[model samples]
Target chain A: MVSEFRIRTETESNMAKQSGSNKSRLYVPEPPFRPGDTPDYSHISVPAAHSPVRPDPLCDADETRDHATSLIRVMRFNGETQGDWVPGISPEIKRTALRDIALTRAMDERMFTMQRQGKMSFYMKSTGEEAVSVGHSLALQDTDMIFPTYRQQGILINRGASMKEMMCQCLSNSGDPLDGKSIPVLYSFKKHGFFSISGNLGTQLIQGVGWAMASAYKNSDEIASVFTGEGATAEGDFHYALNFASTYRAPCIINVVNNQWAISSFQGIAAGEGETFAARGTGYGLATLRVDGNDVLAVYAATEWAAERARRGGGATLIEHFTYRKSGHSTSDDPSKYRPESEPDVWPFGDPLERLKTHLILIGEWDEERHVELLESCKKQVRETYKSAEAMGNLSGETRVNDFTMFEQVYEHALPHLDEQKRMFAQERD
Target chain B: MPQMNMIEAIRDALDVKMSQDSDVLVFGEDVGYFGGVFRATAGLQETHGLHRCFDTPISEGGIVGIAIGMAANGLRPVAEIQFADYIYPAYDQIASEAARLRYRSNGDFTAPITIRTPVGGGIYGGTTHSQSPEALFTHIAGLKTIIPSNPYDAKGMLIDAIEDNDPVLFLEPKRLYNGPFYGDPHAPAKTWRGHELGEVPSGHYTVPIGEARKISKGGDVTILAYGTMVWVAQKVAEDMGLEADILDLRSLLPLDIEAIEKSVKKTGRCVILHEATRTSGFGAELAAQVQERCFYALEAPIQRVTGWDTPYPHAQEWAYFPGPKRVGNALRSVMEG
Candidate 1:
């Protein structure tokens, strides 16, 4: 046995050491553009319009794997709209949608300026993500509830929520429905089928599912839709909602507004560099779609498909609105500190407002003169609404919330201790 | 009326409420098919059907999160954490989401949820299984923390908690599930038999929250205890034949301050007892209140008998527990002063 044994060579140990050095290393994702760097989106590969496969609305969840990976684009770069994802929206609805989007932008611009002028404490503008909410709102029924995030102001604008009420809320005036308890932009309209917005991110996801389950339990035809940013998808509530929705076959649509940035962090920090947020759905056995959030038609069509699926008892659909945050995270944030200052201008998806307007013009349904006149009118309306809202008071304290209101709604029926506290507070005031 | 222990009383209360309200749901890990670890939810799924009572994944955070959502959306959700020690995972949902829903939304929306969990230690379940976290929840403003000492209180308080339109933390003393434990670990346990506290009504009833019960009235001293500590203090008082006023503090958050002040003023001496660790224990709050209210009537500094400041030990459970000997010694010292 000793005579038959072969001798080991020096290259063998060297090869082992070389293989150890070639082992895979940990991966850390960084955005393509950083501060002072040139913005580059060439790494993103979007398919041509109508190129991705489309499964039926009621198809098995397993069949949506390819749809999750591919982008469902309806409006091409040349302003031509041609695709299976192009919804059959009438000219009247299209005009209304465009008007509402313009109004939202105008309102946002006014509120942002107000924050700078110290009229409001804070504001978040949905500069590039308007179509995600507006189109989805147009697709859903009036009775269907929506659990929205702070950025979905377009939903309220599209749903005909009063601009005066919105401005009053921002002002935290006496006319504010929440009694000036909530912060600016966190609106609640229970009668309008809009659940209250929570400042803690990702809470609305499960709330939406629970509401849908309640609707189903009541044997109603209504459904629910919830929205969150891509960074919020990393939250545990989002995953919990997916599991509950998939297992219970809840009738709801979960949306991820992938606007690329979350405050100081990028979307890559949410573990989204390797795959689309829409892919998160297919992994949970859900019918999912990745739609061009800039294209109103694409957003409308995908939302309609998902809602139809939910209504027909096909369970939930997760839609990733492929878009970018074209502004700072909020009035308090300065995006220039992290990302390149010119990134928004060089964004590949283009502005949602611009794309929708161009498509309408190319189809001969709209013109530049009408668009400008509409913008001016929207600005005038916002100005008038802001004037009335400020008369009630702004964040600068021309008016204040009634001290008694702080103790009024803590509980439906105030406990003895609360009543005593209220009495003590009144005595102190006296 | 039928005689039953705290565990059965809790289950019966859930069954009664769920039977009346279709919107009421009882769900947790192993609650449906397995009927829960200690069988607190036994026969619920069979009686209510899986639609109303079902098992969820082993995710405490998800359990509380979904329950909050369900409660906000027209369902009266009673979600159970397997144990009090496991509730930290769901603390955010309970504290931030459920508790603050109505306050944050200014009454536009509310999360009326009841979180049920078995708490405290007597069984040798070691550190992970034995933690009394009543103070953690009691510190939350919008939450109602209720602890039940016996069968009757358990059923009545649970029913009231379910009906209350706020998030309620219903902590059931697990060691008292089948038998009454009165501080002496080696003493023969008292089942519902021959105990008046065991005779719970089969029909629906409610014991209002934020009210304390005067178990025994005397002019010598006031002994404030709740949950298992109530039994321990009562046992020691009877064994020593001490003429003391015993008050059971069922609700900790909206504490029955009037009853506490009345007892402390009458007795002129106070001893607070609980099974939780001494530092920041609920006993501290009671001691503060007693001192503040009865500053002139005090015969001695308010004394507290509580568990040591360490993790609940497995083999040395009695050493850590504020048992009969500890409470007896504290009572004697307060009275002699």
Candidate 2:
């Protein structure tokens, strides 16, 4: 039975004393906590309810206390075995997910080869940040919006964007859906709410806030999730996006994939200790989580919780998926110069795919032959997609058709400048 | 016709348009229940309900971000910034997200949104409320910036802005609101003034974007101005005894250069007046374009009367904005030269 009662703080007068379990105050950590080991991720699981909203920046003590106490729940990935089997992630599905990741990895690998081969201009690999993006995107409602950085093809593949479509985009081919936007692969499914990725850092988070806020204003259950790197957290856009999401209770999930490195800068030296990326969300009175990005289950759970909270209007959630980039920052940067290899070896708990395979085997759900077949099939599919995409033709060469019309779709009636540029391009020599 | 001032004209434009479309919303601090600090949105929330009308946090960044998102997702949101000076914090969202979403998305997404805020100085609002930052927005692509000198176009142009499939920054001239909502920003309405703009077309109609209206047609000289400066130019035109044809530029971006060129070519003389600092004012570009395109039409150099190079002053604001007397002096000097 629920009882109506009030609780007064120890600072209040004794005569105004109140009782009950309300004294079990929780601790909410401030933002930018260190990623490595020490953080009390305990949080008061407030049963999702539409309680009276106390006006913020002037909220009551209870709200402040709630905000202060809600931090990441560090579910240690000590090769654990008790989590749910994420219904529907059958061996076939896992094979598909693996195939998708391999396709993304293959694309990243080949794009670099193409750049070096002087076929394409540039490339950025989604090498190690796959599980968080793929796992989280698959958990979202179909109608939800997706804002991502340049390395989230795993997200697009999982969202059902065909590999041929993505290859067309990366190649800037005439058949590219966004018409040679020269953007990364994931933005191919824009109608599916996957916003185009930006090379400029920390912008998609703000875009996510915009999408989520619009959802709230329109009374829709849809949520918007944005992907960023740990390096981007230092930007003003990150804080600006967070403050907006928390203050308005917008349904946006921020996934800061901490790859432990940002191009040449070690992600370690980017920000000091005790200030994890998840801590950044807590400063704005929102729920947050720091998960083992290598553990698919952990990334899945954190994103699942965040998705539900956003759809249920529990406001926003920030998730930091602790992982490693595993490759050079891009085809252009040399990691060996700054990497110092000591850090990678020191932090290795091994790859996410390997860990998941082990977890599956220990539970008697996976076997060696099945895993081998799965790997071979994934490789086969990646090879096939690349071959077909390669057959589709030139992305950098002169336009073969009126395909430059891709730029024409931006305005309804031709805007004068772009119109002139579009026309000028239309008449240019082959 | 009900007599209304500039603030009511702005609020009425929002109210009537909102009533017609569920997608149109009005949001800003104190705008929901309190009707806004300027009371421009008075009685709107009660009329439209909370979804289409509401107050946001004291975050200009949040306000613009949310609006861009809504616009991208198919909502025509008209967000208000309390003061022009406060828009700096939100400049990122406006410039980066709202302005570029359409272009960056390669036409897959567009921020068909409107940002409304009061600008210009004449009232003693010091540094904060008195700013003319149109040039800042014009420099950013994928954005359509506009300002209205009267309520007739204020309603019509605002409607067009809400309907356009791109982001628009609609700046309201606060000092102009002290009088009629859509009357000449520089003169009281005479029966025959702008008969072409008669009765605001009664029902829903859009004032074409990037077009300028010849508010007062005279052959001697063409005085180009917009927002509050338009009104000042008219008053100065009346005082200088010059046959001035003042063009009220409705849309500043995609800027109705045709109208400016057409007028200048016909008159062979021009004086541009604005309230922004002399450096890179919107008028500077207009003058440059006029000089380039209508180079041979000039009998006199294009004279610009504007706010000094310094930031908006805290005192003698009337002196700061080239009022009728100052504008008159500029017109006289240009004609004499």
Candidate 3:
């Protein structure tokens, strides 16, 4: 027994010696900044303004690989459009884009407050990610279908979805267009080319590719745009979309909003520690671009480039929009748990609203007084819309969704079972 | 009319739909060039153009999600999942996107997509390839689940499922692809030549989505079955000399409640049969509904003959399946009381 103990101890020592010599251990990824740590932006690297030159839309996909690694920026920090990537647009359109961005942020704030006040169930804010959707919306045609994530409410807002109706959907009130079928923020403005927002992530990517394929098959010029976060790129559907997109050369644009964080986890968990999300597109032989998402001009210009490419028979283009999630992931999330409170302040790219406003002011297109007035006007309009939606009914009040809605739309042609259920439910409610 | 098997019937439905409507497209893994693994989509690519019938990567989520997109854009997409076992990966897309499109969009958008999968055991496929997932799809609110036991019903129901304005899960019993599986490993495969439900028409005909076919009529006991169990129950009843009213419940969702109530009340006895596991299988739903609707008229408690609650094993499948003896015992028990 003593000899056995000796041998076991000897073996243990031997393993310790081997491990000490090898120094091998499991590698766990850690976030750049943890809670209680001072927020730091030194690790992040952003390319100079307009570092990537604009290529011809018809250029071979392989020729645009470099664009996937470097950043494409049009608006500088000093409020001037720079380099060849600048999209020449009239002042009216730029002002309209700015207005839509403000409106989106205003709506997000109102909805967030409503959730806190027990008037709504949930809310997700696009606080720092506004440019990604608004820029794409302004660049694409109104008929171009968009399969967007919940954070891209700017698509519907820019397309003129009624603010009152949107508020009613959040409240699940009488004026709710969906008749209380979906949860809050799952908006579907089908007539405005806004595809229904699916709570499941990464589903819309393949859907966008398929929509583009159908449009191509029908010989239509209309293209499709899909949005997903950086973390969703790890899903199998993302890879499938790229494979189908490259094989069929579907006319679509895949926008990956790399907002630095995915819920509680950081972006590194999805893209790995060493690789960029934009590099994934180049691997699939797709035309790719990495844009500064906080720079509204850059986002707009990049979307226009990809949209034009898709319109003229070019294949899909993947654009990685680098930004940060300024607020928590949603009302239910607490950013302080996973990230330093100071992270948003030290973000490399500033706020999207401020960047666009600075550009407009730099070009003498507007003044500070006008900016204040626009901000107040957006807040007041959203507040009024909320009041009207509340008048229709809140969750606890008289809702517009009837008992029959549960059985309705299960099929376009109602089966006997559903018909019976509808009648029974109506009687029970009465 | 041409006599065909279940696989042939499926292929005929695709051919008919593609020929009639230019908007219908067929796609899935290996469906374009090699036909499907089970040959259910054989000759479709050749008959239709490559654009209309094509292959996709072995990504079920992408297949279903992309098909939903096509359906929303005014195309009827028939997506083939190689097996029911591999369909779990696509459940999110099928349940969240395609099923809810019309409801979420308030009738502005609808996904007219049909997902076809070969289901059931008895092919020595083990746990990976054989699974009866009809219950999973049936539980989804906006999805329709259909299973056909014979060639005629296979063709007619598949055509109707494809042309339907909502998402349908067309589950083909892999065991009944070429011949009916009566749960006897030693017995020779039975072709549809002499079967009552085998005479399939060449052109378009539809077995409506919500009706049940009364295969045989007797008043002693009512037997409800679908897919492989329908044949198994029929064979069991004949062998046992039991006067059974055998009903083929083709559609699990949107069930024929009227027919079920009528038959169960008249017979005063019921035995539910399925190859899926006994617990929480579709048979349970049938039993609960039967008891709820015809409890006062029932002379005996409803009995269920189903596969055991275990993964389908390769060598021990026969023991796990609800074979003739098990079904016969259930029939006797119900009739005796």
Candidate 4:
């Protein structure tokens, strides 16, 4: 019955990802009790494969091996000691996180400024909720894949991605690594292990699981991490990815940075319980964790643990970091209309950088003089970088914004009529 | 020279191409091990190994998305949708990812992916399992749409689809998958080239994408059809004793309007037929094109004997499809006018 249909392939990106591996056959056992072809469920025929693949381990370091603990383990790991106010992690990683956090925050502020000045069309900020994205991204191995929602650009920011490169991409310049194939928010950097970012709200979650399953089957030991807001967890891909990851033990770490809002809708509207998004993972029989998203140390620890667990073939873990967006959803939004003015003006409340600064001060690892010195130098450097990028000229000089005819990437070999279309473009260009 | 049916020819083409290029892979549901649901890729998994030929999850979007990823990185992938009816679930990926890959990437990356599926219905596939959704894809600028009427063309067109750089939609007529009867396989291996005339190549060859096939030469009436309807139109012409020039459209977008005009110019009359619903069907496009180009050469108005604007009912499939009898009946009406 499976042999009664055919797949039409010609032209473009209709290819499926398969590695060079000989695993178990798709094992289609004969259906013995053949109920008369009456449709069960939405005349939508789901091809059956009852057999599952066994999870395989990866070659790793002793630290990575011992770190085969889920996000929840990391969340609970020093929870008692966390209140003791001792700073965890090396001095260097902390400063680096602090620096990345500051840069991304500045980038957003500048982006909004540019939007107000009409330099670009649109931009989404990583302000306030920086640590979950900026901090956790640093924990990933170079080979690990990250699928970021718009706000998660901070993940790229934290990965040493250049300010100039980010500016060029948003400007859609020729220097943009995405080569104008991407829209502003939906971006992909194949070299950075970033799969194509999707504009469809919850779609990348499923794609992350699929890539992880493929990686697991290939024994690559590479985990796929995808970002979404607390609100996006309500989408089907969240539950679908979690269930698939748990059932197959695919190397996927699902992160929901509970930034408390998806655009204008409050996170509470997404779920009645208001429990951390990570706790939702437990109902699906997988490991889960909820952490202070503002705390860079917490985000890093959770990510490090989840990555190692995935590398060890222990399956997926869900991490929900509690954070807040200090800026609007994008450059065009006004958070003031939605956000209340007052907050508990204390050291431990809603501020990711402040918590780290407090811990640093308590441990005597960081000094106020050093923070002031770094802030002055970093802000100057950021301002200079933006000036240099702006000097490269707008998109019209850097790249042709009108270059829209692009069908060649759909397929490797050219189709006949499309050749004609290309000829037309060549003529127009000439 | 080797001639075969559409399904067997597709398998032979996959085998030949897979053997030729280390990069070419074939996969989808049931495509591995058991071959495709329509057997278009039978024996590929055993012959090519799992990497080059394998089954994927039931997630159609995943199937196409991964295909896009693989193609973007550099691998020629041939993915199958079990049926055209089921392509909607994966529609966004094809439209947003596969088709737009090059345009969006600004030529830095190319998807170079081929999507193969069995489309159209005359077999008792009912509504859900059978549909000619090619129009949905052909309407998309970045896609190339193809439908083969015979084994030789099926093999040639599919290989063309696999080789072409842009996304191609290869539609195999399931009703014609085994060929000319109530429950008979529309395209059995024995009658692979049953509808196709002339010698077929044994080596790697392409029939050229976006080219139409002229099956019969006549001067009185031009019968424009595709997939199983090409053979149906030919059979009807034979039975009706009408000298109908039949054009088998191998490609839809970048449509061979020249071929249609040449036939209609001499024949002075035109008729279009297909199993898809009449409203907004491929026939509608053909009728519109023929009228635009061949209006002055008209002996009569362009006629379309297509499936009525209704679902492909389980009981009345024969009535729904433009069979030989229906084409013959419609041919007389157009010729007389």
Candidate 5:
């Protein structure tokens, strides 16, 4: 039926061309499925596991051109691991990965509920794209810097950032380290090697490249990793980052989380129609890979490969994490209004957390009973952390950030004008 | 001491800092092998090697963004935007990222980057090449805006800016690159050979940001100007035979309100001048600051001499420029009231 419709549309288009029509019209891309329609991702191609062979970490960028088009999946849907891309990490690490992914989802759920309850102003969930951050974080050294978008909270989670502090930031309470200066979830953890999150999309890509350049200039062993959504690839900073990374051979890894949706607009709006996002890096003469983001082993192996290449001064790599956003863009969005209500259930890439758990169980590293117990413990931990963070303050509570902090941190030292303005502001309060 | 033009002085400053601090980097479009379009970064790449002084792609957003990252990573990067008019493309990086990095990160990270760009008119480069965007940067917090009108201040302030812990927008007046302009386009070109302010001291010296220089002292009226307009104001006061107290505001954001108040209170009148457009220009801020600090001392309403609120036109550049004639009229008007 789909082929017949395609043939009929092509025939009509060809007839219109033959009728001497020279009118030019603007073309806007529309998604494959809309509200009330059945979301059928079966039309989309999903290659089998271990289909594309992994290249050597030090291979020339041109050698990875084929890899950019094919998927580097390690775990099959049946929970059987079979591929060179499989990262044979220890069983303990596999269990830890599963726990971290589960905890990230649990925390996301709790914070989202808090926002809906008016306890916080906003929240963004990583949802089905957990492995993109957790796997990458675990693969890279703890000292390596990470410039992330708002959605990569899993990086901080895997880095052992205090859940109370993260919750306090989200609640914008007195304990919020940012002092209510930043939007909720826009975290900055210097101690954890996580760069401050900038709400402006794609600005951090170039910064990561710059950081890598600085590392190389100083002859340091550390490399930088940066992440942005597929939607933000259209931003000029992304291209600039790739240009500099390839030109100077900066030691860095650039990850584009292609979750198939960018809020109300789909990935096609970002020029994801005919070409893959990973292919964008191939044009810049950088090694590029497309991995199954839901498969934790694949994400870990790809990130490890990229990190090894970067640390060895072999240049940068761009990895596209093919997955699906299984939730609304943010607390303020309603995905059902634009997309099918069953879209998340029908997504081709299954839940990242569930897949990792299944793979662990298949390898005799985890079981159904332990998975349930881990899920409960994660929820309990989130609840207890929220309680402690709530005691400090919340958006709806009487406790608030100190008003005086508003006049601080404008510069390293307070200038005369800022001093005068602070005095005036104090006087007004008095 | 050496007699240097603004461009040479700026280059000398970069060279001095690069020699002093190994972490100091100089880069921008055409700044490496070509020595920059205006020659402001001439001969630095050869002296410092390609690693320290290199060329980047023509991406202002990328240039500033990467500079911010480098700054956070313990490098004092001095990135140049070839022209001030081309800075809008990177405004987001400058205003949103650089300006807010220190504040948003709660002092955990800071972008101590110095963005040096050529500004102001009289070069006849038209809308794309000529602009005075000091006001645009002055409006942003966590940013220190500086515009030097002479060779000595240019070198000293650029050095200070590179060392400062905050992001500094060093706007070098292209019109005063070789010699100071006194608002006369048709006058024979001048050089900095014998000018008193052109004798820049070699090596290290700090002029301090947020401080104003009293170019010429008087008690009749206070004239506030910056960049090339400093010379225009001095020329207007001399040509009109008025003993005006002209203050060259080297810094705009952390304005030397003390100097402004003292001058305005002593003179009882004030006139603000700039080359940027009239509406919401830095002149407006000067006027407001003057009145707020010296409101009771103010004898007449503050007067402003500025370019018209229009896109800088190629032809009729003189009319668009707030020249000596317009400044003279403003000075006379303020004195009369």
Candidate 6:
């Protein structure tokens, strides 16, 4: 059968040659810097901070077409605030933002250590992309719903969710709100307006739009904010969410946290080659903004702008937070195998935490002594929270999730089959 | 009571539910202005206004995903997939997001969305339009799969589904949209105008989900079926002069196992039927359940009368469809045993 198929293919090839048809070739996108390559960002155009003009929240989507390609940055490198995008808040607010960002980093560090120590199954760290989640959380109202991926645990921390509860979730202990049903780091806090985190990527984008649509349909001022990585923009759900948000004018902020990597695959593989990820929103007629995610001020200002637009019924805004992933994708990933270790250090957008800290110090609201004190306080708080969470029970401990509880929430009312199965399980246990 | 087809009954259910509860919104591709290609949502947009019942872009994932979000936000959304065959695009959203939302969140959030889509293969829709994908949903833990055979059950069960707190996949058999199909295509198509099951009430009513309705009671053999296959089983039993206890399983997931066990134990024989492909179809689950529960009773091995393993072919549709002949053969074989 194989030889006969080969002969037919040869005949077809001859016919194609006679017809003068060109042979089709497949093209796969390759990232510029690989494992051993010396990474360079000189080819990337880093515009002056705050160069992109901030448009009116209610401005026409077409007026912001250039914003998709241009970068929106609020803080300059020398700890100076620049341009119209700067969120002119008091020093106190900046200090709070810095504290939240630092605490998020500190929590990520501790949870990552716990996973490595065999206390939890896995972990994902938003090491350098803190501004994207913390800034947005600060900008949006606590009432507005948030649909977040796993990496945005910073949102919960900034929303004042219990550090102990968050740690317990990571530990998959008895105190875990999900009863250890979900994997480690996939947290769900409804009271904090944080949607349950799904490990499956790209599904929450449309749900966010739908929530926003429901809010609008009910004439509620509360909007929704959703986040995904740059790679998930290729998922059909992302495009579908964009189209629905634009058509219905759903009051939502669609954020693409373009941290430049999805696991090992680079942004180019998700069709982020010639155009920006924010540019993909333009085709859906959404107001789009590409902001320097490392700039916490820019992140906050952009999220506030989008939230205001959504509240005033100006419709959805797609904001691409351009940043870099400093750590490996997750506990399971090893970035050294795919990309150069030097890439994170040479990333055009510097660390979000350092940038915010520098801005605070340059403005005379903070100093090296206070920074050290704050870091120590954050580490101590995380350590205490981890201790409290570990007391409830860790994944490796005996006080784990009750196996019989698995049959409890499958439905609101118990069915006969589930009841029978539960009885069987109880019998076996007894 | 008024005579209504399955489509009209479904529309009436949506209309009634929308009127009763302002939080219940209906939207899907072409379901707003056009009232759906199947017309199951006709007049809903005009009556409920655009915000309550609106059209969406042609994106199945978006449709179901948006429904999940809406449900999470305390709105009971009834979204329609144009056809069950087109539901694959939204499978991830349904299986991963909608089904697991409540469980994953530990009851912090719930997806009370009703996804209504026409299913089955008698309309010559061939591969793309003809499909019975209920088994796929039945395999999922959190989703409630309901397939109603007639207009009364369709309307009542749909209302029940929308009111339920969990996600429900309401699979409407398209072949029985306007009438009853008793497995004979050539025997002039019958309308639901005069049928007893078509006499649906105009106002609010609900046929409880997770409960099966015994269409006929007999002693020889027990037939388990749902949707279009229910009527086909009834016709086959009558034609073969077999004393068959036909049970219409309205809900597939939270199945009516008690009713099945009772009838199977009494009859001492069982025949499962569905329009889906034979391999790993819902019939397989039914047969397995019956065997597991009724193994002590001396009886013939359960028979499954279902569509062929091949895709629903356009040219050889009858060959692929498990018609009355196939169902009758199963019944005769079980009776002989």
Measured over all alpha carbons after superposition, the RMSD of each candidate to the real structure, in angstroms, is 6.3, 9.0, 6.1, 13.5, 2.3, 5.9
* Number of the top-ranking candidate, with TM-score as the measure: 5
Largest lDDT belongs to which candidate?
A: 5
Residue B155 CA error for candidate 4 (Å)? 3.1
lDDT of 4: 0.68
Candidate No. with top DockQ: 5
- Considering summed lDDT, which 10 consecutive residues are worst modelled in model 6 chain B? B292-301
Model 6 agreement with the true structure over A1-430: per-residue lDDT tens digits: 1111011223344555553355643445667678988987665656764368998999999988988988888888778988988897889888888999999999999989989988988999999999889988989899999999988987888899998888888888899888888888888999999999998999999999999988998889899999999989899888989999999999999999989899999887787357888888999899999888998999999999999998998999999998999999999999999999999999877898899999999999999999999999999999998998899998776547788788978888787889999999999989
Please provide, for model 1 over A18-135, each residue's C-alpha lDDT reduced to its tens digit, 9 standing for 90 to 100: 5465555444556656798887665555556444766799999988777887788888776787867778888788888889889999999999999999998999999988988899
- Misplaced by over 4 Å in model 2 are A1-80, A83-89, A183-188, A268-271, A364-373, A391-396, A399-410, A416-430, B180-203
- Taking all chains together, the TM-score of candidate 6 against the true structure is 0.96
Q: State interface RMSD in Å for all models.
A: 1.5, 2.3, 1.3, 3.9, 0.7, 0.7
What is candidate 3's CA lDDT for residue B328?
A: 90
The weakest ten consecutive residues by lDDT in model 2 chain A span A1-10
Off by over 4 Å in 5: A1-19
Evaluate residue B78 in candidate 3 and report its C-alpha lDDT on the 0 to 100 scale.
97
In Å, residue A424's CA in model 1 sits off its true spot by: 3.8
Each prediction's number of clashing residue pairs? 0, 20, 1, 52, 0, 0
- The predicted structure with the larger lDDT, 1 or 6, is 6
> What is the C-alpha lDDT profile of model 5 across A344-403, one tens digit per residue?
998877888888888888888889999899999999999999999999999887548998
Model 3: runs farther than 4 Å from truth?
A1-24, A42-45, A427-430, B194-196
The DockQ value obtained for model 6 is: 0.77
Question: Which ten contiguous residues of candidate 4 chain A have the minimum total lDDT?
Answer: A3-12
Clashing pairs in 5: none
Off by over 4 Å in 1: A1-27, A427-430
Error of 2 at A199 (Å): 3.2
Task: Provide the lDDT at B65 for model 5.
Answer: 84
All candidates: TM-score: 0.95, 0.84, 0.94, 0.78, 0.97, 0.96
lDDT of 1 by residue, B117-154 (tens): 99899988779888998888888878899998999999
